[model samples]
Target: MSLLLSFGVLVLGFHHLQSIPDSWSQHYVFVKFGKEHTLECPLQGEGISWICPHNARSICSKASTRQKTLHLPNLSHKKSGLYTCTNALHQSYSTYLLIDEGQDLLNISCTSDSYTSSVLHCSMDKPFTGPSLLRVRSYSSNMTQEGKEMKIPQDENQNFLFDIQLPNSCPSEELMDPIQMSVEVMSSHEYTSRDLTFYRRDIVVPKTPENVTFTKEKIMWSNPSWTPYPSFFPLLFELTVRYRNNTIVTKRTEEQNYSAKDVQTIRVRCRDLYNPSSWSPWSPRLNVRA
Candidate 1:
């Protein structure tokens, strides 16, 4: 009888250890900043209790508690932390609560110089006052590029700029496939992330047209030197003509030459023929004689 009791005690201790979850293993819970959320303990018993985040017991006091659930009415950055739930048997579970603003607070813009260029330039237009960290990553069909985390210093104008280079050059052919991109901004108490999808052709900004000359009721210009395979990837040129009477006329065409009867000044710009989302900066104004 003594041996059986000892064996039964050993079995009970082993079962108790198995019931307890690892303290280091924490499940992540994401919630919007100003929304209400309820956390349910995994262990259901009579003596179940919750341990609030360190130094944040006051915030938990405002929460409503049921038998095994804790309901938080207003979620904020201060409420984000590790929450542990314990039962009568001393078994416990932990969860990390992460709260976000749930909106695109960064207002990030990313673009490439050319369709075939491997480098992408990204900028944040939002003006921030404090120190923060910025990270950007890109995912293509065959490649993934992870960006390096860098500290963002406070600037006078509050604008921040960064560059991301892909592992391979963009494909020349028109591809419908889009590259997935994500930008993450981390601060002392707040974290925000934004995801963007774009095609290479959509973000290509052609170089400004050059060598503009006007003669004999006709205006001619040289295409951008950086443009590759002029026939395969055609460019659409936009011509802006200002007359002596202060009247302005804009015309778009695939040809680099234009003919007009009267003009005082003429400027030209170009964009991708297929994808016309981005236009290059206007070329230098060429004075013309009537």
Candidate 2:
């Protein structure tokens, strides 16, 4: 009977031990770029050592065996990885770290007139992160030419506006497309890396109407004098809008008196003014019946 009782007690004790919770539990998660963060891991036993993944560095908390915390600073992209905390009581926990790619403030606009300067504006939404470095790149589609990198300092909260001289040699009228602009932001901290974000706005140009059709004509004469044929009038359309990489042109015929047998074909094409070698497929030929 005593042996039976002892066996029962042992079994109960073992079951109770198995149900015990881990000694360590993660209390907080921290992530930051170009800065430091503190992580908290609570443990129940003494001699608790927290080891981080980067290099097996040890962080000690003397507050209590049941509680531990560590401070991580000067974080960068390379520091982004799994972090682990462990203690002598066989307690362990893990977490992940992420550094934001950061953010930038930028504005870009273009104009067609050759005499005026093209405007490029840039800024940083959060100047507290550090001094911001701005870079501008421009490209001409027609000439297949890329401009030099232009740099500026962005240390304030307000927008940074800068005037850029358009390429002195504009693409010939046939090849001149709107200029393309891109911006990149760099962290002031030498240890941190930066990324590029692009903002594109095209130049607004006038367009010629295409597919001119006449449903019917109004007549003032009392007699019914109508012909199945319509007249064709001379219509002129100019390429008004410009694109940084491409061009679009549209043409339409003017409304005029036409004989019943008149049929006109309309064709429109878009090409890169700078690089004459490249051109867009011509729009489908439109047939006008008069």
Scored by CA lDDT, what does every candidate get?
0.67, 0.34
Model 1 stretches with alpha carbons more than 4 Å out = 1-76, 79-98, 127-129, 155-158, 243-247, 261-263
How does residue 34 of candidate 1 score in lDDT?
68
Predicted candidate 1 versus true structure: per-residue lDDT over 38-100, tens digit per residue: 677767567777887654587556534434777666776556555667788888766555455
Clashing residue pairs, backbone N/CA/C < 3 A, model 1: none
Which residue runs of candidate 2 sit more than 4 Å off their true CA positions?
1-32, 42-51, 55-67, 86-93, 105-264, 267-290
Best by lDDT: 1
Candidate 2, run of 10 with poorest lDDT = 9-18
Candidate 2: residue 250 lDDT (0-100): 39
